[model samples]
Each structure stands twice: as structure tokens, then as C-alpha cells.
Target: MHRPAVHRRDPRLEIITEAVERLIPRATPAHLTVTVTETLPGTANPDGTPHKHTWTGKPEGLAVKVFTALFGRPRTEEQRSPLAQAEDAKRARDLVGELDALLAGGVALETAPWYPCRPGDLVHVHHRAVGDVPLTPAFGETYIVGDAGDGLMSMQLLAHTLPDTVEHAADMVGCFAAEAADCPVYEVWFEAGAHLLTVVRDGRPVHVGGAR
Candidate 1:
């Protein structure tokens, strides 16, 4: 069969690379076969296009272990008790509320330094956390924002402060923001659950009220 041309660099490939590196950091590819999922623009007529497939990369072992360390392992009915199940339901809602509260008054994403994402229609974001906001963790730490429900938001930190001479912090004075002008930015808290809510549709960053 005739297969159409594929992009030179698949972002899923990059994600797999990043995930592996984030953990192993240095490892020779020998027998490592990873499985990744990709959404492609498929044949369309009147219905919708559905061309979703998986890229091979184990998405298991280390990455899964690390991810689980941050976000607990998903439980099945056989494994989880009824009380645990009830708690799990409430936990999902709690996490959403906590995430919302954290990013309640956040500014645009591009305004931040070293965001993992960039602007465009095909914005690439492999969220570190779950729920509405998939904020990245700090130092692979487990953080608790609200009352800290089972520490669901733990391991990954969602809030960060942009560096500044007049606005940047001491630690962020000369780093992180260097590439802020070049990459697409996802949503970032104005300053850790303090600023206003603003999602960036356009590449332009909105830097109006609030400060980190």
C-alpha cells in the first residue's frame, strides 16, 4: 500500500525521548522498544477523521514508575475497596478544585520562562500531572497546594516565578527565560494561585496585572 509522507520529526518521538531522558538521562538504545500514541490527520469525507495509533516505546517500567510516584497507580474494581473507590471519586473532584484554585488568577502562558510547550494549532503538551491543568513537577517533587488531599498534586509542581531585573527573581535572574521568546508556552500560574486566569490563543503573551 502507498503510505503518505510523514513529518521529519515526530513530536511523539521527542516526547518519548524526553520521557526516557528525564528518567534514564543516559542510556543506549539496544532492546528498548517503546509504544507511543499519535493522532494523525486521516481521511475525511463527511464523518470525522480518526487516525490514532501507537508508537512503540515501553511507556512502562521507569517512566510509569516515576509517573505513578507522582500520580498514584490507577486502581481497578477488584483491587480497590468500596471505601477506597468512594475516596477516589471525591479525590478526582478535589484535584480539579485544587488545580482550579491554584491557577485561578493566572496570566498567559508565553509570559513564563522555559515553558515545555510552544504556540500554534498543533501545540504539543504531555502533561506531567492529570486533570484540567497538567502542570510540571518541580525537581520531581511531590507538592500539595490545598489541604493536600492524599497529595494528588504532589511530585509535580505547577507554579513558577519568571526571572527579572526589575521583575525577575534572584534565582531566575539569568536563566530559564532565555528561550521564553522562542518556544510555545502552555498555561502558567500568574504566580502560584494568585494571578488572574488567561489562556493564550495567539502567540502574544499578556503581561498586565499581578507579579510573581
Candidate 2:
């Protein structure tokens, strides 16, 4: 007997790249990739599209482990047991004043000096899109730092910033912008409950997100 084929949903790597770009226009290719675990399986065809596998892994300990790693927290057995069974029924209709404050900020996972990602650099990003707001790609701006007598030092303007100053033309001192302007965005397709983002740079995945 012959088996039938199954279709899989497209991945979400492209969306994250676009979101980074929207925030920092000069952002260059960083990396992007996705990996699915026991929940689903697939094989690639000659043309390269993945064909979905119908069999699914049962969710229990393995599923809990995957979720904990992705969200930076391990699920407590007690929290997963009777608490889930109770369903928080008492708080069903209490939706007012739940949040204390909604502060706007960016989270940085890496710290390094300025680096060059020239004009022709291509990058992939993965991010979540909600409602109608477009996601921003990850990136940084390029600029000159100082002259080393023979050549000028290349620099990348970091992506995080707070505020700034204003002055007259006579006191026009050029300052590096604390944030990066995004550009050339793309979307990444991901499955529900997947925790890690794999970034394929130059063919092989170099960095993994949702870990740090």
C-alpha cells in the first residue's frame, strides 16, 4: 500500500528580519533558522519544499521541557499539575488593574563593539506579528569612528538608546545615534509552541535564540 502526502504550514523566519529592519534601517543580515521537534516531522522533496509527516509526538514531559527552554523558564511540576487542573476559575472575570505599568523598552541579549555589515549584506530575521503592526528587523547603523593616519576606523552605531540633545550650527558636534534604523524586512514562519529560533548564516545555522 502507498502512503499519501501531507501539507505543512510555511515557516516564520522572514517576518523577524523585517521587524528588525523596521526598527533599524541600516541593519544587515544576522542569521535565521527554525527546528521542529517530536510534534511534527517532514521530508524535503526535489524542489525543496518540506512534506509534512502525519504522526505527532504525544505531549507530556518532552513537551514541557521544550516549552521551558523556549520561554527561559522550566515549568514546575506543581504549577503544571493541580493548578492547571483548578483552571484559575476564581479570576475568570477580574480583568481590571492586572498590569502595574507598561514601560517601553528593548531587551539586548548581546554586548560587543561596533562591527561592519556593509551595504550589500543580506540577513534573515524571525519575529512575532500582532494585530496590524509590522515587526522590525534586527540591525545596526554604519559610521566612521576615527582616522588611524592610513585609513579611517569603521564603526557600527549600536541599536539601543534613550534620549538626546540639541544645539546650534556653530556647536554642531556629530554624535552616534544610540539606536539602529531597520530596513529590508522579511517574515519567518513558525509553529505554535515552538521555542527556539535557528539562524542560518552562510548556509549553516550559527546562532540560536530563545536560549539567551
Candidate 3:
């Protein structure tokens, strides 16, 4: 009887073969040749939501396709419209003004008197059944106002690096609450390594922190 010639496989090839076997248990060495194709960007779907990718082939290709689907492509600055950019700028400006008014004595926490920084804008606080207190902004810091909801508004401190004290965080919350007497409550979000402060207003934030 003639013995068939035994073929030797490279050790590195064997390692890869083992990995492939683990990846696709049902596949054999004969099924190793597979074609993978990726779709170009801007491919549309039936519903009009762009089809992110068109990955075809074996299990490995499927894995790549799944990842691409989960984390879509990042948007470039050029992708944003000019109108959208302008809207963002306007929002930032408004937030800055609100922050400045809150930081300065523009917003009044008490019933004494308050004046608007700009003409045609109403900035007054309604008197509520709460105690009035004076609060002041921290020295040499910039803040940005975020969303206001549930009688609470959020403010974030802006700094090149993290804040160095919990005292500034507390002072910010206190000052915000004092300015907005009607808001009864204020929340402050500071930078990393800093603390959060919650201020329950005895008066509205509008009353204490007179609006601009």
C-alpha cells in the first residue's frame, strides 16, 4: 500500500488557523477565502436615514459592521451649517450675559430696588414668603448659565484648569440663590476636583439675582 505524502503546516499559520476556528466554529479551512465589501458614505436607506455601512462577507466582517453601526462617523466642522453655528454663538452670548448679571449686583435678591442692564428687557423679582440674604460671586472667575428647570438653574464655572477650592463653589451657589429670589433653589456645576453646591432660596433667583 502506498502512503500519501504528509504535508507540514507553518507554526505561525497553525496559530492563525486556530484563531479562525475559534472565531467561526462551523467554518473549515476550505471556506477561508471570503470577500468583504464596505459601502461608501451617503448611501441612503428606504426610510431616508442613511445606511451607515454595507459590510459583507464572513463573521469578522460582520463584527466590523456591528462596531461601525454602533459608533457612527464623527461629524466635521464643515458639516455644520452657518445658521446652526450662529445659533450656537447667540446662545453662548445669552448665557454669558445671564452669568454676568448674576455675578454683578445687576440682579437684586431683596425688595430694596433693581435696574435692568439693558433697555426693553424686564428684570424684576417677585416677592415670595422667604428670607432674603446677600450673596457675592467669587473673585476672578467666569461662569456660564445652563438649563433652568424645576425651580433650579445650573451654572458652570469656566477655567483653563480645575478650580482650587470648595469655598468658591459654595459662594457661587449662594450668590446665584441670592440673586434669583423667586427660584427658591440653585444648582452649581463646577470643574473637576471641585465640589457641587445646592442653594435653597428664601427668595426667587430673579428677585435676588435681578434679571438683565
**Candidate 3 or 2, higher TM-score:** 2
Ranking of all candidate structures by their lDDT, best first: 1, 3, 2
Model 2 has a clash total of 40
Across 107-193, the per-residue lDDT of candidate 3 in tens digits comes to: 212211221121112222221122333232233333433345545334444332223453455433323222322222222111110
> In lDDT terms, how accurate is model 2?
0.26
Give the range of the ten consecutive residues with the poorest summed lDDT in model 3.
Answer: 189-198
Off by over 4 Å in 1: 1-17, 21-59, 69-71, 75-184, 187-212
Q: How would you encode candidate 1's per-residue C-alpha lDDT over 41-78 as one tens digit per residue? A: 75543567666777554433444455446555422222
lDDT of each: 0.30, 0.26, 0.30
Q: Which ten residues in a row have the lowest lDDT in candidate 1?
A: 1-10
